[model samples]
Target: MGVLNVTPDSFSDGGRYTDIDAAVQHGMCLFREGAHVIDVGGESTRPGAERVDAPTEIARVVPVIRSLFAEGVPVSVDTSRAAVAEAALEAGAVVINDVSGGLADPRMASVAAAAGCPWILMHWRGHSREMQKLALYSDVVAEVRDELRERADDAIAAGVDPSRIILDPGLGFAKLPEHNWALSAHLGELTGLGFPVLFAASRKTYLGRLLAGPDGTPRPVGGREAATLATSLLAVASGAWGVRVHDVSATADALAVWRATGSPKFLGTRTEDK
Candidate 1:
């Protein structure tokens, strides 16, 4: 999956593709660059980012989605609002990548159900602005797995097809660096829950912190591409269904290597590095 953030305030690549024409072209480029799915998000959900109204988000993404889907590109709407997801589906989106896992809006499940598209349920405790404060977890892996299971159950009960549900651990949403690492290391536990798992670790803050310099300067967004590829490779080796990455071609290349190499586990056991 290639991430296409259409908001001006997103943590990475914001304001770069807000224009409808630019966004469509970028989506096409990503698609040609080996992106299996192009995820278009209108609002910036970066930590501490303010919320954009549903109408504004819809307006920002609908045209882009319509244009891309018209080209036969596989597009996913990265929205938590039912109205926005509805509009995007109407405009031509085949998936709903809801960061809140249908928690943000009570009607999201119904909308997803009605659309009959894949709905990605990410582990989220709250909205972005207050999410960090809610990252507390007794055991990050177990909590996230169990929470994701609950969400899957709720979505199924709400009329969503079980096979159409995907699980995302929400790496940086409400998780600290350690929490993210724990989830990444133990990703099999989440994937073992029988849902296609999506790991989105592209240029996230924790990767920058992990690669911080001696003086404690975090790595810039552009510098995290290597780390992002590393994460993508490991996540694939660890049984992730897919990775949502910013650098699509790099990830596609690395995945090619993994494929050529017979998908050998690049790193040791999940617990070894941890």
Candidate 2:
């Protein structure tokens, strides 16, 4: 999956693709570069970012999704709102990548069930603006796994097809640097839940902190590409179903190398679901 933030305040790549034409071109470019899906998000879920109304988010993404759909691209609407997800699906999205794991909006599950598209339920505790305060976990890995299971259960109970469920260990939404690291190291725990797991650690703040300078200033977004690639490769090796990344070309090239080198696990776990 390639990250396409159509809002002006996403932590990374914000304001770069807010224009519909530019967003469409970028989506096509990412697809051409080997991204299986273009995840389009109109709202900025970066820490402390404010929420936008459903209408605003729909306006920002529908046209872009329509254009991408017209060009024969697979798109996922990265939203927590049912209305926005419904609009995007009507506009041509095939996936619902809800960061809130269907918790933010009570109607999200029904909409996803009705559309019959793949729904990615990310582990989230609260909205971005208040998430940091909720990052209190005794065992990050176990807790995240349990929480994701609950979210999945809720979705299933709400009539969403279990086969269409995908799980994401949201790296930064409500997690601290250590939590992200723990989750990254133990991603198998989440994958072990029998759901396809999406690892989206692309250009996240924890990576920046790991690459911080002597003065303790975190690395900027542009400089985190190498770290992002490393994390993505390791995630795949550790059993991630897919990775959401900012540098699609680089990630694709790295995966090619992984495949060429004859990693038995990589060879054995090719996704059976198209």
List per-candidate RMSD values in Å.
2.9, 4.1
Off by over 4 Å in 1: 264-274
Residue 31 C-alpha lDDT in model 2: 99
Could you tell me every candidate's TM-score relative to the true structure? 0.96, 0.96
lDDT against the true structure, each candidate: 0.94, 0.95
- Residues 1-274, candidate 1: write the lDDT tens digits: 9999999999999999999999999999999999999999999989999999999999999999999999999999999999999999999899999999999999999998987889999999999899999999999999999999999999999999999999999999899999999998899999899999999999999999999999999999989999999888889988999999988998999898888865357556354565
**lDDT tens digits by residue: candidate 2, 69-185:** 999999999999999998999999999999999999999999999999999999999998899999999999999999999999999999999999999999998999999999999
lDDT of 2 at 159: 93
Residue range with the least summed lDDT across 10 consecutive positions in model 1: 263-272
TM-score of 1: 0.96
